[model samples]
Target: ERLALQALDRADRLGVAGYVLGIARELTGDFAGSMRCYEAALKLLPNHGAVAGDLGRLAFRMDMPEIAAKFFMHYLQARPGDLEGVNNLACALRDLNRCEDAIEVLRPAINEHPAQPLLWNTLGTIMCSLGDGVTAVTFFDETLRLAPEFGKAYHNRAYAKIDLGDVEGALTDCELAISVAESAEDLATMKFGRATILLALGRVAEGWKEYEGRFSADLLEAPRFTIEGERWSPGMDLASKSLMICAEQGLGDEVMFANMLPDVIEALGPQGKLSIAVERRLVPLFQRSFPQITVTPHRTVSYEGRVYRGAPEIEDWSAIDLWTPMGTLLETFRPTVASFPNRLNFLVADPARVEHWRRELENAPTGPKVGLLWKSLKLNGERARQFSPFMLWRPVFETPGVTFVNLQYGDCSEEIALAREEFGVDIWQPPGIDLKQDLDDVAALCCAMDLIVGFSNATTNLGGACGAPIWMLTGASSWTRLGAQTYPWYPQTRCFITSDYNDWDPTMQKVGVALKARFPMA
Candidate 1:
């Protein structure tokens, strides 16, 4: 930084100085500072500059795919033949759910630069995004054949292999990818990939160790978390320690990982104090469930293009002895499938809220009240590939002696109407409670249901956490199963998995048959 500033002062090149500073700030996780520097550079060199490409990638890191696409397009116009710009623009389009358009953009680039392994690898990623694992694997093979040293291609092929139910093969590729990975990004990605494969294959101890790689990847931009001086390791003693467990990742993951919370508290012992920082929406439920510990809401703030997470609720950070990400507890408490306790659930829902929902369901048609969740709210091209289409749930709805309750969040009117009009299934929507926002009440509602069946979304995890009987509809490659047929975290939950997401008819039919067998027509 000193030398760059000295050079700028000597040459009077403000744009160059700003660009250099932006790169430095971004590398150090100062995203807002980086954006300010980049914007200054943009003002100085608005016509055409490398700053445009930097802004495009910065936009992507911040989760603004639309802005990312625009910046990448501008960069493409500035440098038409640049493979970096072409590949990034296509990736932005892919994230924007414009898969076909992304393909069109890639087609021309691939035709012109037939020898470019980067282009081939990007095409493979797009294919994986589209759920064509076989086609993706073929493209990855071509990429590796062109450049055997491309670690990204190896890591990408692992994704395709996992989708094709060759988890062991996927793990092998991930190991190979890590061996030849030269860049930090490629190495971190391969480690994370290996973690997913290991967890899916039921190698829990190794998976938890590899899962730490997430902090090295995109989460490097997040605020640093500490209790007193450092993070708690796998086998750290908690007898006289004060530990803060901050939830990481998505809401569903927080709920799922909370399966280890009870064990963590037990390990802390009477002399030890434990504090937890969780998603704000889960504060009430978590506090109620773990009354022995302090449950505070985690702070998540967004600036220019970065998300920052912190436990600002802690009044005395220095007083705390140790801290760890919530998932890290699994590394200590649960190293194998057998390590998981045979408990029904860890989280306890509001008993009054549970009874209230139960009485409300009693007023419905006299049969078993079954909660049905068919999709996640964030169903984009990439995420939608993981869930079954609502239309395929026709068979499950067709089963008699079950009053289907609407547990599917988001704007799912189309699905509810389709079930009623086409499948003759009238899904009763519980009044007054916001399925997405009222998470505490949602947990109670889940507890009230005779059975809750859905893909592994936040609601399903909540249901499973509270010991509600959950039949999760997932693929054979679901890593959350931890190489077990059932969710060891929630012993009450049953997994109904299919090998193919392309055709969910057979799986839906199986669920329907199971539904009938469980609740035959009265």
Candidate 2:
């Protein structure tokens, strides 16, 4: 530890004690310790732009995004011309979920440093995050112009083009990115992007091959499994080997693929043991849904645990040919709506809860029980496709004998009050139901309602699961495609798309008309 003290002494002499200590703490895997050191150093050298930037980065690492944003802004104020400061500040703002503010902060720096490839690339990422893929594509193109070998920029541009429905353009960008990618991570990203684009364009054969890149260590880092003696093929596999199918992506993906468990079992035959690793919360749902498979409750593979000799782990199955989740597999085998699963039996709400909601609805009126969700998810890339709060359900609220219910979460008290006061409509909202609560109640509420209307969010997912008749207002650049009225997972749901990138009026108008016709009151 003498060497460590000498390093600290050197850092103190350079007036960078905080940064050095923070770095040392981070290297030792003591994130909380690093944060404290950074905080202490900031107290001594408050106006040091570089130290402030490092502090902000440390806060971000700790997931204290709001604090990180504050420090990043302070760093930018102290050193306005520092490119690193500007970039870090922009990223912090983005993490704090101030996407528009992040864009505005980067605009001036981008203008000043037009030839800086990284700046252009960052600007592109911010624009994409803000749901402005059309504009993001331009920034990404500029990044490529400045640095043709920039693989990340190409990969990002492909994502933007995909959002804009320029499938061909996205494919070209992905190909270019794959060619220039040096690292396994970059190559996997490019490959996945290409696979998604190909699947969207209905090019299944190539898409499935590229989609296998998700299994790579650079992507998931999860162990692959293979049985010692077993023949595996597309149509026939009579192996008694245990196959562990782990959830690789988001919650929605897990839900989507859960419908295909029967198909997987069929492919492997009765002798094969099918084990699945999924989120802990979903364990109950999956267990209830599929009794045939052994459901494992593990979100991620543990790298530190001692290996069990008897039981088959994910690592042992690496040699067995793995397949992508149901959606990707369906696309590869039969890239059409006709092949969609018809036996999707989503769990219904508790009978008592459903009956209680039904009684409440019955006592109110003979009018239409309407569920309203105003806000869209800010975390997803398609936030730009969402209509303003005021624009949503305006026409529907104007309709006679329609009771509007608030299904929105978070800080929506103002919006709830405004809707009640301005429209003279009853907004049904229960007490003690905050964002922390699981969506089970919301699903039950949807079941009680005559119709559910909302922007694309968990509400839609909940409504779909309960088999409630739902009208979804979707963004133009949404991951869910256009002209697809029905989602395979939710047979009872219908989607309404925005005609333009940011316009919601037309979609809202259609919803109003549809609601009026479906449930008319005297």
Candidate 3:
């Protein structure tokens, strides 16, 4: 890369050297430098269509989809017949949440390049993202017809089948994907995908075993602690050995997986001391909830023996023998549905914060205070499909003798205004609460509420984790097993799922009826 840059600096004949230097820089992961070089090349040769594509891909990788779309459009203008440019342009539009634009870009590409399996596969993926699983299956079938041995197409097809509620078909595609996988990462991804399908189908034993492929997918965030011994596995004697369970994934996942910690402690017996490392925001809650186990933020620790107990800052290796990811707890602790702790209110809110919210809520009209959360922070088509638009919750907001409080994070001031102006329903937004950062106070607020209702998000998980009565409105395909009305992780929570893709009317109607049962109008 350095040599290419030097050569480009020495002589840029017709901007070709600059283009070569940009490619070299991009290959070396110097995205910013590559973009600069690509821009310089494009400035010299305005008609350099390939350079525009390079800049588009670079911008896409850097999460600047708007910039990527501009470059992709420029490239498409120069070479209108370029199928690859069309596919890339579709990707940029898809990333920008313009699925319709993406579809329009690809429809012509499909007609022009009928033999291109990748184009069909890309269309399938985008359709899956858009929650059009049935349509996505058709695209995947087209890809498979063109290239029967394409591993990624099979994998993509499996995801769509899963979303379409065809677990058996998904499993078959997963097997085909695994069979055609060329690389270890591809094989691991197929296995992990199978795990998700299996787990979603409530096949816990095999699902957890296949979930170990997550590490092979190069997706495991480094564990908080360096293990002195082997990773914990089935039939491992935890009674005599202290275990450290490191939290992985999002805040919601950590909260969900920690449900197995109590079982781990009981299995460890009196001789064992289990330590849990979680995100900093959850440390206080975890410490208060599980006093028997040591809870700390993720860190590097040095220790000698079992005696170094000055608030779990450091631990002794002699006492701590085994370490495992929090998700791994499912393997042994929760082998069956019957074995679930089934305990709600595992998480306890700060009494002072709870009291503060309660006092403030008392100032409002006398009614059942309901906490409302609508959208997730994750900006993706899948998440968007799961959300019941603020407008969809209109009928519930109109319920008599029920006061709604805003627990929905992010800037929804306009939506709140619309509710107040159009529907004449006032959803109260509490002052001085940063719904994103101040999670402890959020938990306290949830605890104080008569009930919390929302789509699946971190706030809903946090509220459910705090043992609040949460009515979680979920999409058709949730990562967690939604076979039963209630999730295994949260005992007090009731899940209300949409009957079809993006349909929340039935769920909202059910919530309305349930609300009437709980808080009858005088």
Which candidate number maximizes TM-score? Answer: 1
lDDT of 3 by residue, 1-522 (tens): 667667766886548778888898766655677888899899987888999999898887666789999999999899986888898888888877788889998998788778999899888878877767788899999999999999988998987877666777888999999999976647777888888787777777788877776656232222234545567978777886788887876788888787777778888898888888887778888888899888887643322110111224545656678888778778787765566666986688888999999999998777889988888788765456556766777668768978889998899888899889887988888888999888888889899999998877778888888888988787555657534445777877777776555356777888878778778882
Per-candidate TM equals 0.92, 0.75, 0.85
lDDT of 3 at 106: 92
How close is each model in CA RMSD to the real structure? 2.7, 5.9, 5.5
- Which residue pairs in candidate 2 have backbone atoms (N, alpha carbon, C) closer than 3 angstroms, thus clashing? 224-317, 224-318, 225-316, 225-317, 225-318, 226-316, 226-317, 226-318, 226-320
Q: Is candidate 1 or candidate 2 better by lDDT?
A: 1
How would you encode candidate 1's per-residue C-alpha lDDT over 1-522 as one tens digit per residue?
666567667865578887898898888877778877787788888866478889889888777788888888888888886889989988888887788999999998899989999999989888877877889999999999999988889998988888788899999898989999987766777788799899999999999998888777454454445334588888678886788889988899999899888888888888889999999999999999999999998988776445567888788888788888888788888899999888888999999999999999888887899998888877665676778777888889888778989997898788888888988988899999999999999999999999998998999999999999999888778898888888887898878888766667888899989999999883
How should the candidates be ordered by TM-score, best one leading? 1, 3, 2
Clashing pairs in 1: none
Model 1, residue 496: distance off in Å is: 1.4
lDDT of model 2, residue 424: 70
The model with the greater lDDT, 2 or 3, is 3
Model 3 CA lDDT for position 476: 52
Report the C-alpha displacement of residue 87, candidate 1, in angstroms: 1.8
